[model samples]
Target: MLKEVYGNECSSRTQVYKWFKLFKEERETTEEDPHPGPPSTSKKEENIEEISKLIREDRRLSIRGLAEKTGIDKECVRQILHESFNMRKVCAEMMPKLLTPEQKESRMKICVDIPNNIDIS
Candidate 1:
């Protein structure tokens, strides 16, 4: 009946059946149960600080190297560098989050200068 009414908008029959069973059992909410395990600690403040310090010390440190030094997974280190720090690797080195206006002007000048400075002879 729900499938008929909702058509393709409805969830799978199995999921609908599960919800129906829960409703029959007087379940008030459809929220999921809390996971039964230790929570992740990799994204903690201390870890972020440590990762930041490590990266500051050596901007060229590879993700694998950071992971090995900090005893954290490579993926976690990468997340901290990218998401938390808003950094990206360029030329195998981590660059600042945003370039200064002067730096942008310098880069533009260099780009324009390249064509004029070139001697095709």
Candidate 2:
């Protein structure tokens, strides 16, 4: 249609047809990009692994410092550590419970028999 309207002033018919074909193909293909939704802002696995390694080497490093070194956002660094790595700093206390006399006697007998190479104890 453009060729009919523009006549010989359109330069080349072959190039125009090729461009129309390409435009039609692109209109269909832009829907199926692998990422699908909005583009991700974070680095890929190898880069995330590097960032995790750096964090492991120094847990005290601030998120800002990590961002400066890794070229990722501070919030991203924190997210990667907290969400991806499941890291946290918490103190846990475990107390030993008192065992019953029978339990203590059985445990001691088993320990003594094991050291003596007795299987039936």
lDDT of each structure?
A: 0.79, 0.62
Point to the candidate with the largest TM-score.
1
What does candidate 2 score on TM?
A: 0.42
Clashing pairs in 2: none
Q: Which ten residues in a row have the lowest lDDT in candidate 2?
A: 88-97
Query: What pairs collide in candidate 1?
Result: none
Query: Which residues of candidate 1, in runs, are more than 4 Å off?
Result: 1-38, 105-121
Model 1 C-alpha lDDT per residue in residues 46-113, reported as the tens digit of each score: 98999899988988998899899987778988888999889988888887679999989998999999
Scored by lDDT, the top model is 1
Q: Write the per-residue lDDT of candidate 2 for residues 1-121, one digit (tens) a residue.
A: 7458545544366555555665766643244332223234564687589777886677666667778998776777767767676664333211124567987899799988886895665
lDDT of predicted model 2: 0.62
